[model samples]
Target: MRQYLSADKEKELIETANTLMAKGKGLLAADESTASMLKRFQSIGIENNEENRRLYRQLLLTGSKDLANYISGVIFFHETFYQCDNNGKPFREILKDNGIIPGIKVDKGLVPLAGTNGENTTQGLDNLSERCAQYYRDGARFAKWRMCSSMSSTSYNFICCSNLSERCAQYYRDGARFAKWRCALKIGDGLPSELCIRETSNVLARYASICQQVLRKFSFFSGFRTD
Candidate 1:
């Protein structure tokens, strides 16, 4: 037995979801790590310089009025947060003036997934909730956390999923009423079976219930989990 969102509140949240999403818009994710950004630059034949990064983002931020129609938000690195357009306004301010939310990548980095070669977990649990509060105060409306889990012969997906969802629910309780958990499966070689589907749904439902309880304590809002 699981708790669910009421219909009236559900309709209200649906109407209030990201304004950008109302007109076929999506978010542009630019919050790659330094190492990841450098790798991305290597592919594009651009040097990973502060000026280059600033110019790149400034270009995107100041590109066109039409850009704002489709691109709802720009996720920035710490360096980008401090950068400004040629007119001297902070990029964060630039985005907000155009109905776009400015976001920050708060996770420190990734760490090795113990016993799983070449797989890893994000490394930012230290004081993360406090950091998120500060970012929210700085004008970030949403946040993203990427976590990886696997279903293998020995791995228990329920425990892993439950733990990850619990952490993300706390993230929302801090300040980001609108946040997303990017849960990726890394080593699932098994095919989806009836038991697997049922178990996965059960685990996810429990996770949503816990999330709703935590959120209810934090804010007087209501909605159902969509994913």
Candidate 2:
């Protein structure tokens, strides 16, 4: 059941989406998981710990205010979304002050898809409404869910909105501005089997439908790939 957006909700979504699409500006993807961070840090002989993560994050956000001129928004990992810098400023607040919008990664991670060899899909749909509401309360304005095509060749990362007027509308009222999801197609012999392509589109459509219904806003996205 797709809900209707309030006047203010529609206005806010349009504004946020416009801001993100500003020419010469784009999103900074800083939402690396701890495991991902560990791999990068190890290459430089740096320890992967909370303090180090916070410091590194600080270095990125606390830079010149001009950072906002180039970076319209920042996508944060769950831990980073809740973290603070050495100066005790919350990371989200820093981004706000710097004129950058704050967003979050909501997917738990990936899981092996059934009847497929090494193919996977994302998890974390459980209790999503509660999580999105709490994230909004804490200053997150957007979200991303990592989804992958159930094909051996490629994967996807989806970003979208989530329930009840007290549920999804809360995101808009509380700051749900933008959502994103991307799925890819590959070019090769027998590549993009009709079944896999349909599977991917169906999943994306279902997820997008869910986001719009729960969040009470309009959102459209597409992702296709070659070779």
- Backbone clashes under 3 angstroms, per model: 0, 9
lDDT tens readout by residue for model 2, 1-227: 44356667667776777777688988788999999999989999999998898889988887666898899878899899889978787889888887788888777887766654445566776656667767778888777665554433443332232111111211231134666544444334444456555655566555444555556554332222111
Best by TM-score: 2
The TM-score measured for candidate 1 stands at 0.65
lDDT winner: 2
Whole-model lDDT, model 2: 0.65
Candidate 2: regions farther than 4 A off: 1-3, 150-175, 187-199, 221-227
TM-score of each: 0.65, 0.78
Off by over 4 Å in 1: 1-16, 116-118, 149-177, 188-227
lDDT of each: 0.56, 0.65
What is candidate 1's lDDT per residue for 101-145, written digit by digit as tens?
676666566565554434455666556656666666666655555
Decoy 2 TM-score against native: 0.78
